[model samples]
Target: MTMSKTRSEGSLPVVSLPLPVDVTAPAVARQAVRATLGGLGLDGPEVDDVLLATSELVTNAFEHGEKPDRLEVEYSDGRLTLRVFDSGTSRPKLKEPSPMAARSRGLQLVHALSDDWGHELCSGGKYVWAVFSLARADASA
Candidate 1:
């Protein structure tokens, strides 16, 4: 994955990540998120939550969708939004895993960890997003 930034002369700060659809994408994304959040002075459990949520989303993209074009991490209005854009039409949904199952828990983890999560179908593909507030208390502990 490659990290890129775009900001107007006086506009919102946006950080965009373009990652290949591969197994290593999740690790790369985590590192990028850590650095970004650290630069923004967000650390401890909150950072951990964001990392976990991002991993789950990225993993899902690779597992269920076509090669994703990018993963976006945006910080605006005191909220952080993580998005995975893939060339897939199906929207993600939470499912109940069987007691003995080892897979299919990514969405559940995301749902429980993120303050708000959803998806939208775009012209070329679908994008799944999870939003978290910087000032919210850590509820995962």
Candidate 2:
């Protein structure tokens, strides 16, 4: 896996990690997100929420999408955003899982944890994203 950090036009930090299209992707994503966000001086329950949301997006990409590509994290204007790209045309939906179900709650958890979340179709495939408001997150801490 390859990871790099860059700056957007707004001079905010953006980190991207190419993820392996396997079971290990979620763990790898969590580790990278923790280190990257921590290095940016972000911590506490909000950061943990971001981590959980990131894991859900990556997990969804690996399970439902095709050829998961990379995970990107960006911080800008008091908000942090994460995007998971995969070569799949299908879009994810927010569904309420059954009480007895063993899975399918990833998106629900993401919706609860993130300030906003959605997916978009790109030229190659699609990317699912979640955004967190740092100001609100800090207030909750």
Give the candidate number with the greatest TM-score: 2
lDDT string, candidate 2, 25-111, tens digits: 999999999987877667778888998998999999999998889999998777899999999999898998999999999999999
Clashing pairs in 1: none
Provide the overall lDDT of each model, using Cα atoms, as 2-decimal numbers: 0.82, 0.89
Off by over 4 Å in 2: 135-141
TM-score of each: 0.88, 0.91
User: Using lDDT as the measure, which candidate wins?
Assistant: 2
What does candidate 1's lDDT look like per residue over 23-101, in tens digits? 9888988888888787666777878899999899989988887877688778766688888888888879899999899
Q: What number of clashing residue pairs does each candidate have, in the order they appear?
A: 0, 0
lDDT, candidate 1, at 124:
83
Off by over 4 Å in 1: 8-12, 136-141
